[model samples]
Target: MLARNDQNSLRRTPLYGLHVSLGGKMVPFAGYEMPVQYPAGVLKEHLHTRTAAGLFDVSHMGQIALRPKSGRVEDAAKALERLVPQDIMALAPGRQRYAQFTNEDGGILDDLMVANFGDHLFLVVNAACKAEDEAHLRAHLSDDCTIDSLADRALIALQGPKAEFVLAKFCAEAPSMKFMDAGPHKVDGIECFVSRSGYTGEDGFEISVPAGDAERLAKALLENSDVLPIGLGARDSLRLEAGLCLYGHDIDTTTTPVEAALEWSVQKSRRTGGARAGGFPGAEKILSQFDQGASRRRVGLRAEGRAPVREGAPLFADATSGEPIGKVTSGGFGPSLNAPVAMGYVPTAQSALGTQLFAEVRGQRLALQVAAMPFVKNTYKR
Candidate 1:
């Protein structure tokens, strides 16, 4: 999420003023001025989210609407299927699914969330790739669908064990929403799109509210003793602990869904010989990899020592190996595990559990082992 260019041109979210008042450290990210962490700092903010709740301002993300010309949501689903490999048609109303926009080579352009809102489809794409994603949709699916960017809405995420207990105070429907359940709901009299899903591996909700009401709602949520204002620093660490991918670091145009260990997201209905299979972009290259597995795969690495192996650290087969076989994409100290964990791409033979590998950090080769992900347990409501 690092922006190397310039900081002056960065855009600010609707909650920028509120973030400043809360003592958030603003940083440049994906062309926006976002909070990296509040005065409580990353370590405490990360742990607070695990034990109680954390309020995140995710308005930098792109929100778009896809409405079908035929006035049938099924038509919109069919149009979306042409771009993604997910079973969008099978997505029932008021439900959401994870999907990726693939290129001709099966490489992921960007990953996003698709929710069926009955009248239209709502999409939440990454901030950096949102422009391209919207353009991609307009270029391919505009013939039968109306593509509009929802610039008036802001996205906020309340994540943790007590998220429901806090949100249910204003929105009564929050308790009944199972995982992936999403639709328009009134939150403090503000009609917003609420999804029972989030980037964190905890039971939480992603609320899409009007830009004007974002500040008030966030302040209200923060009034609770358990909800703390978290920033990008803690957000990254939390998601990293959850073993979730960070778009450019973990996946990009050079990596495919199969290689990223996200094959589970590509539903069976869109695979092999299923009824609606092979209709999306890169269908040939992607589906073939399912049969003949990918050469490299993303795997979790648990450091043998307390020292954290940061991203871009070269990974070697052994401490004696001169060249590198892989590289760390996202690595950090896990607050929950009280140890260092990392994720990176490695050969299939070395991706198995208990495989010992070495990461070259500074001048030392640190011992690490291929380990299971979600370093912390996921408590999503089933």
Candidate 2:
């Protein structure tokens, strides 16, 4: 059984009661009471999602809609382009793209997903950074655009190899949707906005439904024989195994998208020699890094032993001595791999695919090596 808390100050998602009833271990995260694991535990949950389907309640994420005041899609896209380096204007309707909110110093404010919904742009950002993102958008965007916060909605993610099969049972068109495709759909008569994208490097869908109908929708999905409720614990491990970065941990306000190895998100149209170039914040600094390369970069690490080198662990060039070279940002045991895996920042010279390094953990040194990411291969539906 999961532990219960009497604290009433923390915010609750629409599925809070359902989680409690299902043996969810509630914990405080991003100002909300969310489940970190269920009775099955994180390890089982992680492996289960890999084999079948796992239902995730991600209602803590912030959802926003940007509508152009003039009803011209170009207006809203243009305004957003000023904040991100991605070529928003080129985004086709019903398609989604990954982007970051860059700062003047070339640092990342927050990474988010942008979906062009024909008349408006739908966005999903980190819950912790949502308020700041909204404020920044309002302060920078022109009066020709309007930003609306979708505070009355809930977001659910169904991920795994069987995710498509489970979701297709309710929405017939779901199986035909390709990766990053998003549009309106009805599941059991409840209207929802479904996206064929997720953080877990797996074939999945993220459904946005009204808060009032969230429980009913969740219950229906849970009744599936192949579906099980997953929580934050497994979610973190899954994303880490998939080589995805956590907002504040791997990529933060101090880290630029280029340094985080997210340059692919910045389209060529916003780069030099493209149709529209260099309009986003910190364009000069970011573009320079793209040309000359960054001093440090994010890299994946594989532990030589079974001991998991956790986050905040300092890294060194030598096992016994020498100054620290870098630090582990995200680290833990990868259940699927049955080994210790981590991601961190290191000097560009030491960021090769097989560079040897050592991690300091509890006064002991653990051997580590720079490795390619997605520790597990992605299986997105093309």
Candidate 3:
């Protein structure tokens, strides 16, 4: 059911052929003709990753390095903190943190991963924001920090309950790393940096290696009886279940981190009245929002029916109809939840866990209740 020739209008990953050979259903994603599912389908693919181990081709993401000429970590980190809210200066070497790039208006430009390597800051930005993010960094960052896009590298994720077990076979030392810690390692003779982290809220590793070596390394991973090649379709469901945001969908230029339920990502020291207030982009507006409290807040919703409510679905305050309050950002059938689940924005009054709302799917209003995120418990290797 997959057509390789349909890729004429889309970009191709180096492992495109390998994905097809592995029974992947190729689909257009972020300008690339990529795998959306496999022979096992999205449901099974999602479950497999939770129960066993699954590998994903995330090379389409943008990898970048920030190198300070003097190799001063504090200088580079302090400069980066000017654009992001994370305490980059406090990120210990070999550790990583999730952060967002802010616009002048205090809105999130993009959410990205930043790792503190000994000599440079390693980063993974969303694929769709690669060009704009780099441009933003170059235009605003301190002159001491140089931005180098690692366009020649490919990224893969190995995730599941048994992730560390499978990875230990090739890199025994990897098992010691806690969630969000990354370091250089050799897995089955392939040199790569593996981070004990993932978007699915499962124990996993994201491996960055030379682009040319991705296919070979992928093949090696598949050789393990416990690992299967997962596609983007399942990736979405997994992350949705994990309560992770997808750049363009869950957040964008108009969404502030505070309203997006990402206030936790903002360190207390950076909040209003703290030592660092309003130094980053839109600091005044962000701090003001916190002081005044945002009218709307992001929340998780579970439908009372089996029908799925997808992106752009209108959310109403009451099942009968009070008024249009918000809309669904990410929604789908959650294999783990055994029902339809969604995440979206709603008025602060209606964002509580037991608050009831209505989602308009196909013009039919379905009862939905505000639920806690990570519908499934996260089992990250601590």
lDDT of 2 by residue, 1-382 (tens): 1123456667888899999999999999988899999999999999999999999999989999999999988789998999999989988999999999999998999999999999999999998999999999889885868889998999999999999999888999898999999878897688999999998888999999999999999999999989999999999999999999999999998898889999888888898776578888889999999999999999999999999999999999998999998999999999999999999999999999999999999999999999999899999998
Each model's lDDT: 0.93, 0.92, 0.87
Candidates 2 and 3 compared: the better one by lDDT is 2
Global CA lDDT of candidate 3, please? 0.87
lDDT of 1 by residue, 1-382 (tens): 2123354777888899899999999998898899999999999999999999999999999999999999999999999999999999999999999999999999999999999999999999999999999999999999989999998888999999999999999899999999999999999889999999998788899999999899999999999999999999999999999999999999999999999999999999899685799888899989999999999999999999999999999999988866788999999999888999999999888899999999998899999999998888998998
Ranking by lDDT: 1, 2, 3
All candidates' TM-scores?
0.98, 0.97, 0.96
Residues 1-382, candidate 3, lDDT per residue (tens digit)? 1123463767777788899898888887887888999998888899999999999999888888898867797778888899997778888999999999998888899999999987889899998899999998899774879999888788999999888888888787788999999877888787888899989989999999887888888898889999989999999999999988999988998989988989988877678576665579888888888888888888999998899999999999767766789999999999987998899999898888989889887778999899998889999977
TM-score of 1: 0.98
Worst 10 residues of 2 by lDDT: 1-10
User: Model 3, 101: alpha-carbon shift in Å?
Assistant: 0.5
Candidate 1 has its poorest 10 consecutive residues by lDDT at: 1-10
TM-score, cand. 2: 0.97
Task: Give stretches of model 3 more than 4 Å off.
Answer: 1-9, 272-275
Judged by lDDT relative to the true structure, which candidate is superior, 1 or 2? Answer: 1
